[model samples]
Target chain A: MKVKSIQCKKCAAPLSLHGGGHRIRSLTCEYCGAIMKVQEDFALLGQFKDQSHPDCPLSLGTQGTIKDVLFTVIGTVSYRSNYGDSWTDLHLYSETHGYAWLSYQLGHFTFTRRVRYLPSRNMKQLSPREILRVNDQPYQFLEAYQTEVIHVAGELTWIAKVGDTSILRDAISPPFMFSQEETENEQEYHLTEYIDPEAIDANFELEYDTHRSFVHPAQPFKAPIRKALSKASLIPMALSVLFMFFLTLLNMGNTVLSERITHSQMTGGLFVQDFTINNANHLVEIQFDNAYGSRFQVKDITLFDDTHEVFTFGKKLKVKSSTISSQQGTAQFKIKKAGKYTLRLRAITTRKWANSDRITPYISLTIKEGVMNNRYLKYLFYISIISFLLFYISRYFFNKKRWE
Target chain B: MPNASHYINCPQCGNQLPLTFQYAKLTVCTHCDSTLFIEDDGVRLAGKQSVLSTIPSLLELGSPFSYHKTSFVPVGKVRYAHTIGYWEEWWVIGNSGKGFWISVDEGDFAVEKPLDLDSRDVASIPSRDDLYLGQTITLWKDQWQVTEIDKGKCEGFQGELPKILKVDDVVPFVHLSGQTGQLITLEYLDTGIEAFQGEWIDPFEIKREG
Candidate 1:
């Protein structure tokens, strides 16, 4: 079968067949360590179809016929040295240049391997001492795909297109460098994120099976913890029902009280004052007369919880042209505890104050007791019963399941 | 039964993975991130996978089985067959039957639909040097030879293969010769749409006297 040989496709190393049937479809090339296949029709297929991820500095590999053989090599390293520690280079060349310098070393290891082109005239040839040092270090570049060493020992020979080093350079362009610091900086923004279920499961299974694995304590679903979880799930539902009942009663009472206030009219003053607390225990109403002449505007009204300013009504309030009438302002503050409070009232208008020493109506308040609607009591009763029912129902279910 | 099979090597790391069955469209070496395009043109470097299969029923095989000569001219144009769904296949007659489901063709390149991964779709279709959507590509050996580029077709719709084609529409034919390494020959269909032309050298230039 006259098929397109893999050796003819590459530009570097010769395909030295390593004891394989020539008729076989695919064979590994000994020179470049690349697996060559013979396809009847020449087609540029996918690269890395059967190969591992390329290591930073790749190893050597080849394709195409022996006369047109090409080998490729690639690797990566990090350095703390002045020249930035690591060097990565990939070169491709024909096999005619048999002897190749793998790499060089001053202290540790520095050099090149699987080389097809010689040093340019600008490059200095290694001295005997330098050669000895490189030989002593004895580092050979690996083949590009896998972790295989590259070592060459032979007489030198010249091949066609020795200057085609640029082809290899074009084949394996330098990859973008991401330093360690930059990589970590990038990860900081992405670290506090969720991993997919498969990834989490894999990590848990691989690294910490002891702690992460679900322990089957004889019976899987019949454990006491299962009963606890089942019981706990009912608590929120019962509490929600009781909460809704109290909210309804409070809404009903507020509606009834607002209706009674609507029927009262302004009498004996510019604003009439009326106090109605359904089921009132003790409530008081205070009346204030606007003393400032020529209709003073209401400035700011602030409700304070002692030193804490709770609410402030600072929007505009208009007053009519009357000063002798009783100015009515009602504060329906719910007092959780009976206490005395100073209600400061300040009224100012741009019409101008005639007397600077004139005193405005400010009152001191003391609430002995306030009305309590059945809504709150009803809410408490409902919550207590629901909570008790939930607890006992859960306990009963737990006992029934666990005692089984 | 199996979709396509490609024997490829890692261009960067020299790793090799024979992509077979549904996995032929796209795959990455867990070791390296080098990409791979399933085609029949350019160089099949180490770690590259080429499918080895005969043309399937859907893939049309045109004239001239075999002839050895130095000068081979691409007879006609290699037109792109744009179908809607993913059921379309590109099978070649190599030593074995090989082909791929070209699931996507952006402006510049053609990509194969991948295997059943976590996401039931292709991770990504790789870009080949010569083959692009709407362009006529040739088959070199077992790869694709991008010959002439035709920007004639409007941007294609995105969808699966079977959904795209009418049941009556014919599958395009891929042609090759020992004379020229690649040739994509498309049939003149009455489907009314214009066909993309591949590399065509005038036949009168060479003497067939031998």
Candidate 2:
């Protein structure tokens, strides 16, 4: 389709109509800001002067291919929100795909196309945070604002003036945003998708700032490694916990010996108990309990195989507190020999207000075998949980910033 | 099945024109750009239509293209000039021996098939003045929103067409869109109201068949 070159009706400035076909209704002169109605023999519509041009990099007739469709920039409209935020929308026309828009704001670019699908609810009735399904995809309303056409250049599909305002509401479903624009006469819906600045640059073969200052609502989070880690850690984390639970149920060993020693049975402050060991493949536990408030101390606990000391644990255990009715402690060790094992305990007094020989405490001792140590499994579970949290926390913050 | 061919002489230029489709009502003489209207009695020269200028396009007359895995050969085309620009409707024949219209307005493309108003329980269609943009109406057992209401003239034509069209004939058409991409077009012609039902086609999906 060829566009005829014409002079501006108001300023007589030479202008070449590169595109927009017959759909564009108004052509604005970039020199004197004169808007002409293209259908009415280029009649002067209005003059909008003293307006600043937006920093748009794409000029009229700049051709680019987006999603395999070739489009040319034919018009530009600069719009300002009610809150003073400004952006530029470049009108794109393709000979085969009709009109579209490339919006640029804060170093971000998004492609927009008019959609016939009306929102489930009216634009004015929708509030922020409300979810509306369009084409079965959920879109959450982001904001509603008034957009004023501040400046215009090239050609537009409608007769846009400097102060033409429309109430625009936007809803986002990541990678895609649905916008509803309502004027006094008509309501229109447009679908926009966030385009990476690098993609825009590559498509047009031009350098752009590409330094986005804020996260766009339609921009998808791109942390592939973190997302993969978060998802991949879940199975192993669950498996580690399940293994620990099953290990605890299956490793409860039985007790082999239980004995009691009286205080008067000590001759040289030594009490001996002979216990036979059955299985030496697992761990062994020796537990002792003494009468509470009895001022006594155990000097040494030794396991001897026919008077040959196999293991000696010499730790002083004192029971002095009167509040505790009984004092208990346990010691664990690995034993190899399965023959007769004799355990000996040496006792002494720790109190000065009583007779040293008569204040010996009565003690009860028990020996258990085949116990399983699960310290390594417990550490593995903790590590798995921390690794998952690290990835999850990063992704959570990334999403939070995107929504903000 | 046996294939049949039809030929006619241009009343204006005495040039022989081939009418490939049996239902072809109009054809343009390639030698003199004369529009030949085929009637039940005989062919007559309707008028001289302007020759279409060369432009980059996906479909060409006598060329086959595949859309949605179905091959269609364009036999004729009619260009309608609107207020801002022009749109072309191509008369295409599918591999199944059915004929359809492929409308290309700027970049918008639609494959439209003629709809019988009586079969769809539609007794009448609203006049061009009675319809407005964004207005919804029930037709063909579905609700359609009026997206555009425009009047154009038959500016130029080429090859063969399925309907009798004269040069500079006023064509008033209304476009309605469904919730999905379905489209219903109503053309108020001199004879009667002609309706077409179709869906929007993505231009990228059309592949030129060799």
Candidate 3:
């Protein structure tokens, strides 16, 4: 029979009819202790005794104990609007000794239910009273079905009780109507098509029956740090790349500048050479036998004599680089005066580094002129005196505080 | 499918002319007195003299000094200037010889005194009184000696050229020309005496003017 909603006439307290095949001879109100007779059938379903009863009101069930109850939940194949559409799977068996019913309490409502044992699993084949059973006895179904609303956030869950019987069956069948052992003798087939016979006994093993329902959390599930960082997008990465590119460009410019400096100060050679100094024209020429060991271009060539500055030559001096045959190497300069001068030479070989920290040293050389008191020495004397005077005048007032 | 070079004969004057780009019904002939209307493949009438004009001009080249501040003094007596129709002009000159011409615009310039030149007559002067940009001196040959050191009421030439002004922000420039070779541009503010100048901004700047 269907469970109904009831209220006390005096205090207006609500109560639910819960047990299957339950009966009552008389009832008294707890507030007023007044007695009332128990009534049966659908007409008096939700009606209760007055507050004048001596104790709480009770109702009775005319059928035997509720039994063979099944708790089921159906959810949308995808997702849907109904909450109760999700059910539990709890099938029970009962005996004449006591009333048994399956109860599932999810959040608010406790779904108390019982089922009947019909001739077939198909409900359409049996009459109402014949199909519906309580405590191994038959009772007609009360309504289409009872629905108790349970408020839940995401997923629907419940605890199911399937075998609540006063009398114990000698053997119990497996909870589900299918098992791998029962289908062993059949031809090897897909597991989806398998089903087994339903049997019940008091002493038979019963699968653990306590089942809890819970909702699985929905998620884009990221840990706190990772999620926060991802939300910032590619901004940090872009900044890093841009910074690296600028740094690389700056390094390249510096390399170019340093290379130019080295090229201005070095040169090298191998062989006997004749040096000439033209005091009037201020020119010097060095002729030598070319050493063919390497294709060494003169990176820079400078000529210095005693105390004055000769050509501190290089690309800066407008000295064009030339490739000479193995027979000869010639170096020339525009000298201010004729003199025996110390000639310094350097040859820089162009090279690129494969590693970031590779180092390249500047190439250098030194050559001393023979004997100092030559005719060029007199001209140098005058040049030195004039240079001193110019230097003195140029720095005449470099260190003065003005605007004070 | 009409080719651009095809021509038709005029029926009135028996003259042949190519079709003009513009579409029109009647055209006036340039060499004859007649009106011409092209029908099918032939001109039906001859036209009077048609006015002729010269080709229109677009994207004409800019003036000579179109670019500004576009020159680099890479080293001594060597300057590269980016200008009209050229990437850069390289100017090179031996210390004592006349500077070489690297462009059609500017010819050779003289070299006053090469620091490495041998003649004692040549004297050199430091570009600036400051220690910045590595102190460098401008060398003058003995012939061009410092004759006077005037120190009063000195005034620079009133001009907009960077080489003329010595005070107010512009640095002293190395004035180089053919025959003159290399000369220090001493502005009127300099007074040819270093005593009054407190400090120098740059050693010397290389200035190029038309």
What total of clashing residue pairs does each candidate reach? 97, 3, 63
Model 2 lDDT tens row, B160-181: 7888777788988899998878
Docking class of 2: acceptable
**Ten-residue region with minimum lDDT total, candidate 3 chain A:** A188-197
The prediction achieving the highest TM-score against the true structure is: 2
Give one digit per residue, the lDDT tens place, for model 3 in A1-404. 24454554444455333322223222222233222333422222122223111110111221212222221221101111123343321222121112222222221111122111121222233332234332243333211222222211100112111121111011111111111111112211000110111111111222333232431111012245433444343444445455555544542211100122233233233211224443424224343332421333443455556766566545542324444423334444455665455544454343432356344333223222221222343344444444444433432322111100
TM-score of 3: 0.14
Q: Point out the higher-scoring one by lDDT: 1 or 2.
A: 2
Q: DockQ of every model listed?
A: 0.03, 0.45, 0.00
Off by over 4 Å in 3: A1-228, A256-404, B1-210
Candidate order, lDDT descending: 2, 1, 3
User: How does model 3 fare in lDDT?
Assistant: 0.27
DockQ, candidate 1, comes to 0.03
Largest DockQ belongs to which candidate?
2
Cα lDDT, model 2, residue A179: 95
Cα deviation of A387, candidate 1, in Å: 26
lDDT values for all models: 0.28, 0.81, 0.27
* Superposition error at B101 for model 1 (Å): 10
